[model samples]
Target: MELTINVDETTRNGSLLFKAARTNDTGAMKKLLESSDVDPFIRGNLEETILHTALLNDNKDVMEVIVEMVPSLINEPMTSEMYKGETPLHIAILKQDINMVHYLLQHGADPIHARAIGSCFIPGPYGQCYYGEYVLSFAACLENEEIVTLLLKHGAPLQAQDSLGNTVLHVLVLQPDKEMACFMYDIVTSFVTNKQKHKVQSIENSNGYTPLKLAAAEGDTQMFNYLVQKQKRTYWTMGTISYCVYDLTHIDTWGDHKSVLDIITSSKKMQVRKLVDIRPVKELLHHKWKTFGLKYFMLWMISYIAYTSIFTAVCLYRPLKRMPDNQTDNFTVMIQKTLAESYRTKGDYIRLSGELFTIVGAVVILASEVPYLARIGPRNFFGNASIGGPFPLLMVAFSFSIFIAVIFRLLGMEQESIPLSVALIIGWCNTIYFARGFRMLGQFSIMIQKIIFGDLLQWCCLLFISIIAFSSALYILFQTLDLTNYPYFRDFQMTLYTAVELMMGLIDFPIPYNNVTPSFIYIVYVLYMIFAYLLMLNLLIAMMDDTYWRVAQEREELWKVQIAATILLLEKRIPKFLRHRSGVPGITLGFNDDDKWYFGVEEIIPEEKGKIQAGGIHMAKSVGWEVIRSNLARIANMKEYTESTPF
Candidate 1:
């Protein structure tokens, strides 16, 4: 007779032979665990293996059977079940089951296996995995001597931090009970070796708190003495970072601004351990000093000479004072005599000087850009160029225009005056350019604002369409009415101009009121006011406000790029000798191949064989780029939703 007793437990979720351990049946559990057909170590829906349940029921016979069968299960952390992500050893220690803990440890369990992969519950930075819930951290939290010793002898790391950034020492200092405090002190004295002391004690967790600082904050005097007696080195390696707490006296209890020494010692009056690096600022200053001192001075000398001479020529022109045909004065005679003294004939000296300086300014523009322009195509010139590309060229054109305008007017030749329009444009462009030099008032932000011009252009197109709609209606009305005397609405061009200007309350309606108006015309006027001024105007304002906020979010990165561009442009104007040298005064920090911080932002070194070699994770910025890209995608999806949705 075949004894066919069903040994496997079955449910709707799946079945395992873990039920053999439920009745504390060692022989049945051993047979199931060793059976070729039955997988006794399989975890269930709650991520509970048979070993976890057996440990809860204090079945040492079942626990040993499973450990002897499935050795990998010794280090496998539980996921989402009771005691989430805790290895069997951690749970055994927590329960004070010394034998079970030793059984798992002796089976080659990982001493530093913090948690299972892909089972993180604590949120950290994107593209990074945070391994929280260290077993040592857990055992130290229990503050038992045996548990602590067991994990330490197995070579558990003291540096592994939990979800809240608490180290093993951080957890140890929290136990203030006299008996437990001694146990915690013994744990600290056991493993903290000499070379690792400064590194271990001074390591600041995410909250900028060291173990000593945490103990001080908790007011644990015994733990404080335990740390101080061992921490012989008083001084700390100092640097200015966002989070570092030093001498506790002067600093506030909580902030990224204080140092570790600021948190523990009572003498907060002591100067903080400082590591200041100012090589960048020093180099920038030296570059500016020499650049402005030599090359910039030469450019300005020519520019000022042209500006003053051209200005004086215009100021001395007779047209400015409106000199009459019969008018005669000693002032005119004296001006003529002054010109004669410098020349062989009348107007020769003034003309020559005006042309000379214009040529000087024109040459300055060409000299500054021709070398760069020769190397790259015009498309690249515009693409990689800053705002108002080839701008000095415009200044050159303006100078030459004035020179031409003066000659034409002096010779009594009939021609269009170029100086008036060109001078105004050149002056305004210069004002915009100088704004880059002094961005204190943020007036030059248009340079940065130019990047999101596409978004702004889309908004302009919407406003333009609205304007065209309102103007078209008005054009039809006034054109049909044949209102000849109404200059503001005489044609579609004038009508469109008035339609835009009317929204701002610049143009009053009911024009040509002296004559009688049709009733339909008045009706059209009211509708135009409602649609154009009331509705469309407000809609346009909302779009502009939204655009400004989007632009404002990325302003810092935009400014950084603009600053880099401006530095490049300025560097081109001066020679290498006049620029900064590393050994110059105040330039203490070495400028070597390792230092790639030239663009005003740190360079990113991608992960090389799974190691972050840099001091910081280099940011690829404008936090708003990711934000705006997602928003644009979301908006695009919104359009599809509108198209698909039922009205």
Candidate 2:
């Protein structure tokens, strides 16, 4: 007899209308809807409406009654935190109830504007696979083409993006399996007009990832290929001379100034094969080199030359400190040198100028490292001790060496020679960093780097241990025998040198029948030779060979990574205005209508056209403006003739 549903009672067992809808009880639902006290808009558990409960129960008759009597409740969404923003239509799609979905759509259930902003739809722990906010986006995420079609038929916009700015295509690309994404891509693109399709595909999410770039970033090569194939062409091909034009904006830099090269190279999930082998990316890199990379690379080379030249000149021109005869009195010489007031006579302008330049150069070089340290972070720059890489640290070391030499020179000490020698060695060795500009040199440098860091480092450790073990044993054994006869084993220092000489075959075997020398010493020497020369040396060769082969496989990727880092670093150093002026712009090919290629403009040299095909190899030599204009004119005329003549 009490028609009004209590809130507590509703929380426990849902409202009377919701209960009736759950059972598909048509008569009880009719009585509930008729009762003025029973509000049709009341929500039960999870703040689900009567329509949502009906759809959950598949109560078709109850849903039909509620739609007619309480039309306002049709689009009413769940108010519960997790399930909020989910209307009856969104629920029906989730339920996979086609008839109910259609019936709700026929009435007033909105499919286009209705968005589900529930916790489950958002990108978080609640749901790893974000279905997006819009109803159509949800259907596309489910991979239900039929339900998606139904939503589209009811005026659901494919161009509509969710709260995250991801369209249906963007969501599809995020799915683990890209097959459904490709299928949905074709379906969705077909559903929209040409203009709308472009907008839908190119729409960037909050992270600046267009669906295509997202696929590339995700390493979904199949999905990326599909998207590329679909969008790379603006029109159908015709005639014998068909042309293919590419959209640079689709493949090049997008979202946060990241290039296609940047995305693939920096992605931890992307395989090295994908980074080096992808055709478009390879082309993009080539375009970059031709456009701005060559100039920047040359500038870096000039800077390096200037840098190394300054240090080399300083070390060469630095005046040597004169010492007195009877240099054997090293303590007296050191004391004399320490007491000397002036390093230079103050008359040697050459030494003075050299020291001044050296100081300036060292300071300049040290200051230059600040940019690199800031970019890579001081932690990584100084922390990484790979002798082959860490270009910044190498420069830092070189600068400090010069500084040490300069300080010693100022103090009238000969100690500057040691640091000067070190600085020269490091400065020249650092030239390998510039070798990345050339492919062959870059590969060779990487191989050498791998060998030194990998095989050679381990070999040095083993060699050191072998020398220490053998030298110590030989010293102890031969220490008791020698009275200046065999000076090689007279002490630990001499014995250690002897161990090295023996390994190098400098010392002959079998000491001239000295009975005082323990027979056990010969046994130790033999074992040392066998372990060090026979086993360890061969093992070192094998390890080097293995490292060489391994590096050969990854040669291109490593080289490209080096080059990419250089290119990015160079870009950062350029003044923002000049850099923007040199920025890659949208290139519009004259023959390819008005669709601009936002990547790079390619030019073919007219004089080089004959040389384009030589020795059975067709080289795509895009160079000079004349060739591009010539090709464009020929293609345009051919297209015009083909169109006028008809099939």
Q: Which candidate number would show the highest TM-score if scored against the true structure?
A: 2
How close to the true structure is residue 273 of candidate 2, measured as C-alpha lDDT? 35
lDDT of 1 by residue, 1-647 (tens): 23343332323112435566556778877666666666555776668777777776788887788778877777766776334676777667668776777777888877686553334433345312232367676566566567678888998888777666766666566544645755675565567764475467656667667776665555455555455434321111113211111121111111222332233222111111110012222233333334443356446545655575575564344232234446656344221222223345456556566546655654565566566555433543333323334454455556566666656656654342456456546644554444444345333344333432434456567668877887887777677665666778888898888877877678688388877767777787787788768876676567667656764664443333344345444444555554432111111112221211121111122334443221122222322334334433332222211111111
Off by over 4 Å in 1: 1-28, 34-37, 41-43, 46-65, 75-105, 111-466, 476-479, 483-494, 514-521, 527-647
Model 2 lowest lDDT segment of ten: 638-647
Q: Pick the lDDT winner.
A: 2
For all candidates in order, the CA lDDT equals 0.51, 0.68
